[model samples]
Target: SYGMVIGYCRGDHFPNVLYGYVMLAVIGGLYGCIGGGFLGLGLETTESKQPKWAQLLTEMVAGGMLAWGLLIYQLEWFMTPPRSELWAACLGAAIAMIWYMVRNKFDRALRVAIYSMLGAGFGFSFGNFIQGLGQASGLSYNWWNVMEFILGLSGGIAMAYAVATTKWEKTMQPSRTVQNLSIIFIFLILPLVNYFSGFTEEKIRDLAENLSVSDIDSFVLFQHIEAWLSITLFAAIGIAAWWQRASDRLQKWFSFVMLSSLSLCYTLLALIHKGFFHIELSIKNSITLYLPILFLAVWLGTSITQPWLNSSNSAGNKKIWQLVAGMTICIILIALISIYINNPTDRTPQRF
Candidate 1:
């Protein structure tokens, strides 16, 4: 959303690339807020005590604010002027997570957070290097998408590995409310936010044309269905889940519903844009567009197969030092790659 907005405002790729640093920081903040909040919630659930909603909210807000603040400070100081400043946001988020973890004494979760942060940091830079190689190869594929996939894949694997390998205390299952709300945010709210942000008037018109849509009124109706209709379906599912709040598999059911609904939304949008009977080779190439859905399906399958692992109180000073060393190594590696990919024509670093 901000990318499109900045692109339109700046009217050039170079300036947009510069401003994109700020946007990346903002995105980092969002990720930190979501990630930290979810982790805190999970940790709290492990105890027999009820959910501490206010404390969780505070931690989330603090994580987001700190991440954004640190990145902005670095940008203002022109720190690493020629290189990407996204690492600052990652560091800020890690610090915030550790601070709250220390407050709660969630040693095991803290280690997981540190490991995940390091994985994401390294994954992003390494993904960028791979993207650069792809671009240099003159391949017609979407290298940017490949980078995103790598970043997510590596970060996810790191988190999962951390959870599985570490011994954990038995945690109370998260309540239906927590599970439902998390699913809503992940599947409904997040996508809607992204959709609305990029759904400008010009974009709508272009989409209509691209879909081979001829009638403007028809397109308007299509938009309404795409937006409100899906919301209605989601709301119905939400209400049903609430009514059956006692179900043990509410999270799994909600996950399946959310993914299915989102997939339906995308399929309907495409079908409405282009007639059902019509087909094109461009449609074949657009398979890359739905790769996220595939990824999400795999993640969902994994979660269902292996529920949240039991956590332990085993993160010691030695592990902390190791994680710190790992993060430092990631920084140096990213720096070397950034220098290697540096191009005069490309003002933006060729990295995630």
Candidate 2:
């Protein structure tokens, strides 16, 4: 809903349909909230207690039909709606019902999906805000997509840790100081960064659309540097905390710091890159680009290692790390092969 609001408010993509999109989101949210509340109340008041699956099935059907009707009405309001709109609405309703049924059976899947969606939404919005800041700062690189992807990944990890573990609160209880700091870092610090650094929609769109593959490669290098830098910084912190006999809360905070740093650094580098604003790359520009990577590498490490390094069971840790490494190598090899097959000469240094 908020994504729709932001997209509509931009006025570039949906000039004539801004009001319509906003109204659709508003109605959808309201309908979901009110109808859900009423239905929940009805379920609570029922005298004949139905089996949980039966109750869930009933809720899914009701919710799906309600969503379908609401979506169709909204789509019809369009001046010349596509027939696909009806099909899309039907698909959405079916997905919702199926999701509910599946979630009723597997609670963990529902938890993960809900958290993932929340993470994705927050990450996307935050990335947009950061892109705006980058534009305002005269940094012309387009890293908004990367920012969203990394932030979403971080959000998912953090949320999964928070939800999946029953011992999170207990584990962190001894380190109240660290937990409070983590909260501040995640909520207050990050949002402030976005507010201060984000770019406008028009600027972000222009840069993103114009960027080249080489520019992206340079950006990827920056990502690699940032990821390793974050991992190293947090690893050091974790080590120090262990030495000081700090609580597990510090470990959790370390995780957040690692994720947050990677996300933030990407956004900053994307903004600072000149490819978006300049036609030709210069030695000075190259030097400027290499400096951050160098500094971060020196401060952190040259490569990313697992976050659980300080924890025991080093052999088990190696196994998990090996699996991740294998997957990454496979992906890179496949991508390279695909590119080679597509255009052998395209491998030559090409600039936009």
Candidate 3:
């Protein structure tokens, strides 16, 4: 509905549509607020009445659809110069769909958390970029860019808030007394692949379409190599993380989130500081990339939970299954995230 309305607003045929859509957004905001209050200032579910599989399907579908739709929309958005007017249309549709999903009844805490983490991720990302340019010697953020960053932050917060408070998905949180340190170790090891992927250069993409074909072969090669290296590393990390995630090790759940967050540190401190367009394919980056793998290997050697040894015992089957189910959820979530941005360009340092 909002998409149609946004489209109509910009059409030369309908000047009246703009005012009505703005009014609708205002009204929709109120609707969300009122419904959210009734649902909860905040509430935790005590009953295990909800069906886990159905909720998992809903979450998988919702997360997948949002990622796929946004990728298609944003790709055209970021790449196109002639259709700048339609960007708002994409934004409106995204917000409307999110509102519909969040307003549904489900588990409040889980929704809030999923939304919060996503928000934090984006906020942290934008903040990193903003600071990156601001701190650069020759770069400056005028009033326009500052305003843009503020708007980005606001939009991210709103989206996160919508996701977190809604009872949309109901999956059990891992709170067993066992500490799953391997999960964290694996997450930490994933991003080293990003910084390390500089070894191979393939003709993967053409980022500088404006340049004459022969003018910047060297620059293009550099960018392509960087991209390949980064993405290869990203893939390696995902596989390693999933392997540990599936292991029957006792690790704290939050540790996994923290480990995943190492990508942020790499992006902001190292990637950004190095500046854009300077990334290259090289042997050094490739060799250093194995550091995370080595660290994780050491940690796995001392991990407290022994999955393989216990698997032979029949009564320990439940614990193994719990680990299996937990890994299933994590891998599904990781797969959903991977669908969005596979061939990450130099434009963005990629992370989930």
Candidate 4:
């Protein structure tokens, strides 16, 4: 999604930085909404009390509003120019999630958020530097996609490691209906929203033209079919949830199916964006398409094999200090590297 935004925001492309940033925030909010709301749904208080659906809604609203209204809009912190500023939104969402955890005393899960933020932040910065190196080498690869995959993989690993090392209470597990619904949101609904939202009508037309699709009308009809299929899938999931029979089976294979679906969706999306459908493969296109899949595979594999929340999880003062220091060094190094490797491109905006 950030890659698409970058393409659209380039001066030679759409030249709509404002639109880019707004969409970035919206993307962040959407992420926060799903992530935070699901986390809220998954955890329970010590007394076996669970958060109400309204409270989960509050997580979505708070995360979205804070991500949009705070640093992105009001404070105007353009910390990483030419890159998506959704980090601000992630932080905002983390704050909301942490607050809820503290309120509910789901303290064990707090490390998941903390470590995830740390890991993602480091991954993004490091990935940016790596991307710069790739570009400098003039390699025909999608470094941006590599960066995004690194970010996701690092965040997932950090969260999982945190969970694995921590001894968690056997809190109440949500019902099958709730679990199924949550899976649908994460694996299907939100991704579909992203697909439809990112591939706007204008974008589709541009992509179609570039791809030499003579029948633009038919191409658009194809997109409409995709959208309709999404709606049908969503409705089907809802019906399955209502019935409660199929949802269980659905959950068992949901990850694998979603992994394949998303990988194919993005690959097709990339082919259109790249304006070609051919047998010959570019290393860039391959990485851009498959790196996320690889990362997801790693995550899925580790999840199935790894023991979670079985060991002691402690964040002592020394560890906290070490984290802060390590993060500080990484930030400084990334800043220096970015400056040395390349000047900001058209996407970099002057905030002050």
- lDDT per residue as tens, model 1, 196-291: 665556766777677676685667666756666655575566556655655787855754655565656555544434333233545334343564
TM-score of each: 0.62, 0.31, 0.33, 0.63
Of 1 and 2, which scores higher on TM-score? Answer: 1
lDDT of 2 by residue, 111-188 (tens): 333333334333443444444444445655654544444454445443443243312111213256785677556544
Residue-by-residue lDDT tens digits, candidate 4, 1-352: 3655433222222224334433433343334333533543354333466665587457846885787578877987665555667766655655676677667665555555565556655665555557667877778877777767666666566666665666666667567888778867755676568667866789878767866778887887676566556555654654444445347677676555555555555555454444444224655465445645756675676457543345654444586579858866655554554445554466554332
Off by over 4 Å in 1: 1-37, 46-76, 80-94, 165-200, 209-216, 227-231, 234-296, 299-312, 316-352
| Local lDDT at 266 for model 1 | 55
**Cα-based lDDT for every prediction:** 0.54, 0.40, 0.38, 0.57
**lDDT score for residue 258 of model 2:** 48
Per-model C-alpha RMSD = 7.1, 20.1, 17.1, 7.4
Q: In what order do the candidates fall by TM-score, top score first? A: 4, 1, 3, 2
Residue 62 displacement in candidate 2 (angstroms): 12
Q: Deviation in angstroms for 314 in model 2?
A: 31
**Cα-lDDT of candidate 3:** 0.38
Better of 3 and 4 by TM-score: 4
Clashes of each: 5, 9, 13, 1
Candidate 2: C-alpha lDDT: 0.40
- Looking at model 4, residue 154 earns an lDDT score of 66
